[model samples]
Target: MNSTLPHLGFGTFRLEGQTAFDAVSMALNAGYRHIDTAQIYGNEQAVGDAIQASGVARADLFLTTKVWTEHLSRDAFIPSVKASLAKLSTEYVDLLLVHWPLNHNTVTMEDYLSSLKEAQDMGLARHIGVSNFTVAQTEQAVDILGKRVLLTNQFEVHPYLQNSKVVAKCRELDLIVTGYMPFAYGAVLKDPVIVTIAEKHGATAAQVVLAWMRQQGYVTIPSSTRQVNIDSNLKADSLELDATDLADIAALDRGHRVANPDFAPEWD
Candidate 1:
């Protein structure tokens, strides 16, 4: 399994045009080494531009990008990644992912897994994984890959939507859990429980939530546009949470998912 991925990453979802470049540039300046983006997000060019402008050596960065559902077919998979690498201005991404598990009618699990492995074998991605997959699908993935080829699973996880079921399975398979929308799309920031915990820690609600995820051993990719927010989010790694704090945060789980789309698979 790949180990270059940090516990925290800079997400580029919805960040595009000049906004993506600025946020990514600031994120790099704020000391983030891991950057996450996707072909579906239509911002690989901006991410590439930011990396180029940041002057941070490619060797120092852990770049992650996802192959959209449209490109999961064997024919499209490798070409899609090649396109992404060209757009990112990088020869290879540290990690590549199946953005979502869908359209089973078109691409069988075996086919997609084989294609993803083909990408890895071709040296397009140093490591490969999946996003938004449940335990059953991950099992199928493992069986098809026939090894621990997946390095992590990116999913929507937060205090409101704990996702313990998926987290448990990924842990069982020894795949690191990458929690996207760890803030619950900003809905959890002003939550009463989160507020109370933030007060005790003297940290922002974002920091408290991020710290909880970190303490739980789940990697998070929380996005931000402000420099203060980016810097503060990074500090979440240092904000230690105690048992009581953990329990309080745990009590806030209501399965409040914020990123679900109509095409999303049945969630774990």
Candidate 2:
């Protein structure tokens, strides 16, 4: 149950087969200890293989996996997590998340959330939280769990989608906000605002965006298949942004979201 989470993590989304394996291995080689994946990714085995092959002691790494929508039932939850653990080749994950809030037409929040806590009690997960959850849903989850601490509420947060409302709620609840799609799938890389800032700081557009995320007190998981990009992203940990830089990036928000599915909740 490692409580410490790396501010910058390596994301594994839309990555599969040997590509996922190679990218993860390169990230580990580049000194990334936090790895983010999900049951929906269909590459957990590949990620697990990369971890085992990296020889980075399991204790030295922080691994997170999310339980998918179909597995949210009380009867299916724990077994789904066990299946994930087997694929990850680990006894337990540092943090586990609900991939999406249930629609409540099929399963209620209490059923799934209780299942999450039960998994923690069984030592299948060190911590638990939610993903793609709205502000109201975040509060409901907190109330449902009572005193159980939610380590983080992971959702979309990038320069183009600041997601301030949900972020403020997570902060108020004392939960860490982990932002996925930090680069907005490379769309922000071409933004003139980000480009100008990158030139001023002599940094890459990716680094500038990542620095914005870290400086805002949010954790970001950015992924890349190229070794150079993977190695360079880790350096964002030390890239500092001044007040002007922060404010400039803050104004770039256009309420753009990249991960919206038909099943997504009504956002804050």
| Overall local distance difference test of candidate 1 | 0.91
lDDT of 1 by residue, 1-268 (tens): 2355798899999998999999999999999999999999999999999999999999999999999999988889999999999999999999999999984578898888889988999899999999999888888888888657899889999999998999999898989999999887799999988899899889999999989988889888999999999999999988998999999889989989898888888877
Q: What does candidate 1 score on TM? A: 0.98
What lDDT would each prediction earn against the true structure?
0.91, 0.92
In candidate 2 the C-alpha lDDT for residue 160 amounts to 93
Model 2 ranges off by over 4 Å: 1-3
Can you give the lDDT of residue 133 in candidate 1? 93
How would you encode candidate 2's per-residue C-alpha lDDT over 1-268 as one tens digit per residue?
1247788999999999999999999999999999999999999999999999999999999999999999999899999999999999999999999999976669999889999999999999998989999999999999999744788999999999999999999888888999999989999999998999889888999999999988888888999999999988887767888889888898999999899888888877
lDDT, candidate 1, residue 150? 93
